[model samples]
Target: MAGFFSRSVRATADEDAGSDEAPLRPIAASDAVRRVELLDSFEAAGLGWFWATDAQGRLIYLSDNASEKLGWSDGEAIGKPLGELFIPERFDDPNKTQRPLVFLLSARNSISGLNVRLAFTKEEVWWEIAGKPQFDEKGRFTGYRGSARDVTASRESDLNAERVAQFDPLTGLANRERLTTRLTETLTSYRNSKRACALLTLDLDRFKQITDTMGQQGGDELLKQVAARLEQIVDSEGEIGHLGGGKFQIVQPDVDDRGALGELGQRLIQALSQPYSIDGARAIIGASIGVAIAPYDGLDTKELVTAADLALYAAKGGGRGQYRFYSSDLKNSVQERRRVEEDLRDAIANGQISMHYQPVVCAKTYKVQSCEALMRWDHPENGDVPPAVFIPVAEDIGIIREMGEWALNEVCRQAKQWPVELRVAVNVSPMQFAHDDFAQTVRNALTNSGLDAARLELEITENVFLGDIGRAQGMFAELKELGVNLALDDFGSGYSSLSYLRTASFDTIKIDQGFVRGATEEGNNNAAILTAIVGLADALGMETVAEGVEARDELELVTQRGATLVQGFIFARPMPNEDFVDRLANGQQTYEARGPAKYRAARKTVFRRIGLIHEDNRYKVVMRNLSKTGAMIEGLLEVPLGTQVVLDLGGGQLAVATVRRSKGALQGVEFENPLISDGAEGLCTRHRVSPYQIEAAGRPLAALPQDPYSLIMGEQEGAGSPRQFVEVEVGTPKPGTGY
Candidate 1:
């Protein structure tokens, strides 16, 4: 074959030579045959393959070796378009500047080391192909001749290296570098078109406890499970990336609506907080998320990330297992958190903390069976501080163990003074429970207070199981030996694991308030969950307590579900020790279930000034408490019922509400539409005043300013209208006025 091709090439050269040009020399047939044999040996060695295309860009020739490697018979790949046979690699280059293969073929340009995938092959095959355009004597396009080498092996290695650089090895999610690049590109592109994007930053709560308890291998496995859950929840909505050490970031484009973002955040929290089974051991963890939307929270990547971080810090500070949206006040909240952390260290030492008790009653008899001890703080300068605010700070500041020990001792002493039948349940922190001498500490408290071990119940959460199983079981044994009852508090709240019940001996299970709050609502599976939990407890010979039974309907549901004990405001609120003792001494042991007929949305107590817009007038009022569907406000007098008003809650959040109940200076207003979670423990309106609107109102486009209402009002001239009612100062009251 080579001898014949050499003669033909000489003949063609002779034919094309002009009269003035020298004729080309023809090779000897013997040397030509030797060269042909050498070429055949090269093709046989599988070093490369030769291919040719006709003027029409269709394959005319394919090497026999290449055809065989692709599982194709001889001449099978011929007549197909070269572009169709081999497609350009879909894995984009980091620079993202490569031209399409079709364009190069159409332009008949020279291709050098162009990597492509063999589309016709059953197995994945990559080739490094090089070709040059061929022309006829008239300088017209004729065909292309190319050589291709199988690069599947080298390409696989390259891809593996790229994956290591671009993704987290343990979780197989995008790494920080890749996420940063993607975020920068997305923000740049979205900026030009005025599009919106949302970024959620999340960090796992109590992850450190898991890492310390389980080995690093266990932590890695837990992260893989977390990544799987995140992927399932996010699906195709956005991209998720691991930011190292239990932190993750998600970018969802065209999702700036607070309602949708809030829902997504909540789903993530719920999914991550579920129990994780790693290597036959049960683990529970929680997630805190911070969300920031483009053009409102920030306009650039750096600013947006900073905003999201601040929001996440606030969410974790508010108490983990929640999400928060970026707000202007978060900066101040950070400094306030720092101050609170410092103050918390002194709170325990100065005796500013106290324990209050709420009774848990028998569901059938309504007789007080036990009381759960709750921690309360009275800051010297800041006044009363709720546990939700100070407890997380205490945990972070390394004072929770001290505080927990104090509470245990105090509760035991108080319980000794009560009737022998009444038990005292003290909540134990995971940090304190993991201590080497925790059981000993409990024993000492019991002995010192002269409190019977049978009457002392130590409430523990699922987090205690996150550490060494042997240690946790040993602690349980020690506690049991001391004769104290053990109850699983906040059961089904984090990592709801039935396996724990099998492995650890729990005397009781306290149902979380989350399930109880919505158990009676239609379409809520919590009612069924309650029944199942009660049955499970019964099978285990453990008592069940229904927590947070705030309404008569909820009480009825729990009672019907056969819960052993009921606890919540429907019976009574947590009272000071003095009040509790006084009531016990008065023999007020039985209480009637008196509460609202049906469950209502939980309300948050707040004391902040807000702008109340009525018609063209804006009045300053104080929002005393807020819920998803309504709020109680003060400072406006003689406001008629059903009067429409808009409440400016700052940061561009405005809620349209109507006065449902009006009194002398206080009114209860119902929202026209229900509020949504602000990604944290707060409620917010679905939509906010857009920066575009502010720009159109003659201001630069920027984040929400301090006074969005003033921007909307655009400088009112004069005292617009006479004050309809006198403004009463907050914290002051008229002698005869009442709400």
Candidate 2:
């Protein structure tokens, strides 16, 4: 019967259009009989068959199965639109057709009735149908036929699956997948405009701590609340995209300037700052945002996203609850830094890196007391690589520990060869501190080098304690116990106004060069800051040193501001070990004292000269200065305290004096007796020593002094005997004051 109905509709469609069409093929007797049998079988299978008129918009045929399925008799549904049979009038437009259902059937050829839903007398019911329009042999328009099945429960289940995929299970915001779709489309639309957009990437600060302690379910609930708040904030401005697990990316098109972008970042941070009501519990979460402007920081989607991610890292690094604008240089530097990191890893393994020592001078004394060990890599191909370049690279690549250990070993090895009184300061990378055996490693370095622990200074930055504070404290304490001097390097560079002196057990603080570089900027405020830092150091019982002194004025300024130690190019550039020692020795040669001859107040006093004392108690003395009656002596050791000793003032008369004290290699003695009497002529005749005039020989001449002992140890030794050694008494404390 359904087949006959389909054939009649097609023949009528051809006649109405007045188109010549081929006659329908005669139905096979077996097929005609089978059609009836198949329709009956479908009824028994609980499926419904129906037909709607192409023009009349009426249901012309209905199977007995549908009446039974819908609990209605066949006569009740015949001649009426199927929509009217099951659906209420209020839910229908009498003149309107089911265009969506009709289009799906016509275009798709067949559609599932399970996907069809409508209000039926205000009651919901689902039906699945398979329908296709029949056509005459010549392909003229015809009628439709299909099977329908009720599937309201299955339809609802399928819809739930789709909803779960599009929305986040926890927050119910667009999940990463959906966010990616929206982002792609948004970017594509903006692609042709050439206008810049901004991507603000945010991550909750310390979210892991909350998640770790609260359990997964609790963490998820908190995240849901966070997402809801974020949704509310961006609902008016733009779309909110969830990047999953506490990360989000808010994209705004047509950003004006950095200020506006920064403002937006701040707004997001502010919104996240409020306490969230999650699962009946109040929770607080801190957030950091990094904003990257399109076409400025990056032009492409990936580049922009990466820049924003980097900026986000920078924000979190700077300190939580803040924001940083992405810069082109940041991206460029990150790329270049990655390259340098690769170079650093190779350099460490290949021994291409070397250490240079920069002397840290005592500002008042003008003496090279300590040499800071700075790493300098002279790549065979690259030449001199700046410390600034490779240091950061090494730090980033995790090979910093290897490089730092190399630095420590090299510093200690070369430092052992220098004058024993001079100390070596090595900069320890933060990676060194984080090493599980950092303290043990340092101890091993000291033990292996045979260098005194007190003479070895390890420099650390304030950020070294940022991660695992307790571990940092414990490691620092252990290092301190080994007698290594601890200096806080770049003291004011990190989060400042910290009483690190009181909290961290640091023995010294090296004022960042940035402050000192402008210390003498024509009465700049930097002078005050430098002075305050020095005073603070003094108050805390810690020594202060200034770095990056490039000019004489800056040097003088720091000295006057009470900076006891200073390191910079003005004094000496960091040099190789040999050159550093040579520079020190040369500096000691031409430097002169500021006081009048034989007076106590001297600008440049020989603090100490430490060396292995010869077995022979009597040693040669070299007079750095000479007078008729007295001389200032430079020797390897100090005379025993208060011991009167005779000096062969060379070329004759013996002078005797009492040793006052020893300061390193310099000894102070009070003249007990001058071998020569009054006038130069009388002194020369009695002492059998010629009174050489100042200009007569290529050496210093003796002159009689009111203070006779002034010439006691004043004879210059020209023989070069014990050339490197200066003679004086042993066991004097003053000469070794610093040691």
Candidate 3:
């Protein structure tokens, strides 16, 4: 009911007596009163709010309407501190973009259209406020006055715009720009503290084929599902972003453990590779991951991203559905892959590719029942090229279809020449299986070679069910009508479905090699799984083939588990077509297992030079074999058992171990901590030497060096002791020769 500030605040300020400009003219008494009424009317209309705080920053007077809007009466707000009026919402969330309102006010600075949140409201409400510090005519401090207007609608609109810019519209995951910003900021902040982070880039395999088969909308739904699965796996450990279609990026801060990052990558690939149902359509797509750790791989955003991308390229080249860690030689590896892919284009025409047969023997009688035709590619320079490497390349270059048809015809032709009653099985790729004329192709193969349909077994993997299930079922019926037997290949590897067994008339289920490899390991449940698979197959009137039975113990275990057929190196390595016929003519139809009697810890045969450190002395030695728990190293003649040492396995990896066994210059050392899977077919140490440690020892921060100890070890470290053992020269060991 009392007087308030004048209508034109600047005009009122001009009425100061000591101002430089002439100001003798002033408003009359009634006009001044009218201006006060106008100011009150402005507040009454709710267009804006008026507020005044004491010199102590406490509220003296507040707009009645603004107070009422916040569920507060003037009595409730008048005596409250100005800071208590606005409390910011969650800073990490999208609603908050302002924080300087209180800081500017506390500093007695002019606030111009500053945004702040209003507290004590049931819902979030934002206001744009402006104020100036008040003073007496003598310049003594007094309470301040300011104006505020509701900006919640505008604020919400701005937030929506930001979200649209920062997140993928389809998947609701962070978009590329936001991801880049986040990685850049993280790397920048971490660099000063000498911390570590990791980047993992993913590319979805078979995504284009799936999209073509399922249509655009279905493809979009699949991307959303992928994002959901990523969130479930990554959770809060890192940030996930959709870097455009079918490509994703993950940033993990304060994490440099390769073992842990490798596990995360593996889980991501496995989860993404599983079957997805999109609007009644089932699909399967794989993921390839590339990993790069900060400082070791790169120190900045561009270098790290480039390194990760190169690693991803290598992963896909090695074979999709795999993950690869960044290495300095990855550029060379990628170039080698391109060369291999190019050479594969003319392989079949040049006679560089041929067929070899590995027999599928009966588990009980140990007699050859059938043969699985494995393809071989002999590059002029590379000699023998693995199917695992070339097959994926063929598929990528669109040559697998022609090659698959060739294999089918060649197998039939070869089987016709066999004097024995051996049915030959041929592998089928998913891309070839998806063709509408695949059944016709098989028909042509059988007719061309004058071979019976029953003698041709077509091996199909779970990937064949990637697209339309009904369409796949139709293909199955057509193939069955052609009288060619079908066997599920790589069963239990992934995407196993009993519904497939129901609809498709598969004659056999070939258990994946992975199940057989670890069946005999202690505490492993693979035996039970093998038995269950056999039981299931038997109940369905189908035979089961246990694959990869190398050792005699694996052979006996598969037999005991009720597997009807077995295939692997224990029986014999795959022989050429000429040798296959020779063997049949020579009456060598039965195979007795020739592998080691019992299974031991699986160790990979390797031949690489490594550094063995004992005390202050480092010795260059050859590592012949490596396993999770131990490795065989050669050098340092007559090394004592139980002596502690460290193995430098490159890339700054140092494994602490104790010698468990010794034979002359060769020593078998057991690791204090076992190595873990590197998200692929290799094992790596869990932790590596941080470059910061090297920097702390007086070197500038940089990427990992070939020998980190050279930078970390002090000069006096060499004065500790002389060499304790004699160094022996290591000759190159022949392949398959035990240390």
Top candidate by lDDT: 3
Better of 1 and 3 by lDDT: 3
How would you encode candidate 3's per-residue C-alpha lDDT over 33-57 as one tens digit per residue? 5466567778888899888899889
Best by TM-score: 3
State the lDDT of candidate 2 residue by residue for 467-543, as single tens digits.
Answer: 34556678888988999999999876544435456767888889998787655546568889888889999988888
lDDT, ranked from best to worst:
3, 1, 2
TM-score of 3: 0.92
lDDT of each: 0.86, 0.62, 0.87
Candidate 2 RMSD to the real structure? 29.4
lDDT per residue for candidate 1 within 653-693, as digits (tens), equals: 88999999998889999999899977556788888887767
Per-candidate clashes come to 4, 24, 0
Clashes of 2: 24
Clashing pairs in 3: none
**Residue 714 in candidate 3, Cα distance off native in Å:** 6.5
**2 versus 3: better lDDT goes to:** 3
lDDT of 3 at 127: 87
